[model samples]
Target: MEMNILIERLQALMAKGGRQILGIAGPPGSAKSTIARGLAESMGRAAVVVPMDGFHLANDELVRLGRRDRKGAPDTFDIAGYRALLDRLREGGPEVVYAPRFDRETETAVAGAIPVGPDVRLVITEGNYLLLDTPGWADIRSRLDEAWFLDLGAEARQARLVARRVRHGDTADAAAEWVRTVDEPNARLIAPSADRADVVIRLDA
Candidate 1:
């Protein structure tokens, strides 16, 4: 699927008069967040983004558990916390829900950082593992009405990721090293989840 196709489907769904909770999943640096932002912006106020990164464990906790080195690993986040938030969103009840937000600069998830209002009809939650139907992750699919798997061309996503790491304070060599060492492996693991997505998208810059 292309980006325009997604926008078309979104508009169609909106026209049909039912809320669409669309999930976008992909490997690290695959442009899931970028697509989510675009979707929300295109949808206007009816769409709000609630990121899965918001459940990232705090730095202190990760350090305490000796998982700082593997900061973006599956175990480094509070999956249950994310689960609760998704569950609430699925219910679509009245009242505002304040969710945590991940800060890349600080590398931590700050509580009550994003406010999800009562009237938001669509939510775009993007992450690497939302479509992963693994042991502890089976709960995610049930929470989302539909999910899209973002598939960026390898060279493009990797280049974007390397530049991102460099911009965020990593030396060029170190960032490349980190991307190859940790990020690439995680990206490989996330690919399998694409099978579970309702839509598979190949997005390009």
Candidate 2:
């Protein structure tokens, strides 16, 4: 879908009044963040982007759980914390609600990074597991007023994943290996959840 169409749809959803949380979900490399930011930017003060990435477990915690290598897996995130934030956002309390943000350069979640004012009516949250039907994730779909899944061709998605890794400092060979060994499995896990989305935005087309 075009960006303007997406903005219009989101505007209609917000038109219903009360706080609305819009979820954008997809596999790794689908550029959900880009879409979410675009929508939020277009809406200006009316919308804020709160990514699920901020719930990523700290590196030390991941090591303790022996999930360091599988850092992007669903279990590697603070599911309960993310759910709580969404619940609060939907509930619309606190004069100003703060949300964490993931810093790619530092590879850590920075607390209180994004603030949602009381006047803001729309929250655009993008993530890999918002529509997952599995335990610890199923509730996420219900928390959002609308959820969108971003779709891209396999080859295009894989290429973007590889390029992202390289840009983040990984060598080309290592990036490809990580994509094959880590991201591909996660992508498989995320793919089926697409059916649960209210809308599927095809990025490859």
Candidate 3:
């Protein structure tokens, strides 16, 4: 829903006992990272974010699998790597754990990058596949204490995705075509998992 309500919900969750993990699940263009950042900022130092984009396979790895052309598709990522990170983070291992971070311009994961430290209690991890039940991602929701799904209009989302691709160096036509063809199918498949979320929110107008 709205930002104020979302912040309140998070605050309430944070107030509860023990450690809490918040999973923000949405389609590719749904602005999940933006919301996660905003919420963490609002909460000040208590919240820290770890994005799922870090799990995306490098360009070379994608090429090895012959899936470079379908980068946003399910099979293009390193699913086991992501699952392992989640498991490690959940176990409360070392004083700090370095996670991968995706660079949009380069379209690759930079490893040992994002740091999750001992002080941060609430982990806000946003990703498209957090709610997906396919293979490695199936146990994802169980690991997260709270999950939210961001809902946005299809046409608006497609526009955002197209603009993002274009800004990241894809030709305008190519961006639009990729949004229509590749991303939208994934979005459709990802949408149903909203039902699994504890909260469903529509972005502001």
- Alpha-carbon local distance difference test for all models: 0.83, 0.90, 0.86
Candidate 2 lDDT, tens digit per residue, 115-154? Answer: 9998888899999999999899998999988999999887
Give stretches of model 3 more than 4 Å off.
none
Q: What are the TM-scores, per candidate, against the unseen true structure? A: 0.94, 0.96, 0.94
- Candidate 3 lDDT by residue in tens digits, 174-193: 99999888889999989999
Per-residue lDDT of candidate 1, residues 1-205 (tens digit):
5668889977776675656678889988888888799889987888888888998888788989999899888878788888888878767778788888888877778899878788888888888878777766778887887788888877888899999988899999999998889889889888988889887877766
Residue 196 C-alpha lDDT in model 2: 96
Of 2 and 3, the candidate ahead on TM-score is: 2
What is the Å distance of residue 176 in model 1 from its true position? Answer: 0.4
For candidate 2, the lDDT comes to: 0.90
Give the residue spans of candidate 2 off by over 4 A. Answer: none
Off by over 4 Å in 1: none
Q: Give the C-alpha lDDT of model 3.
A: 0.86
The candidate scoring highest on lDDT is: 2
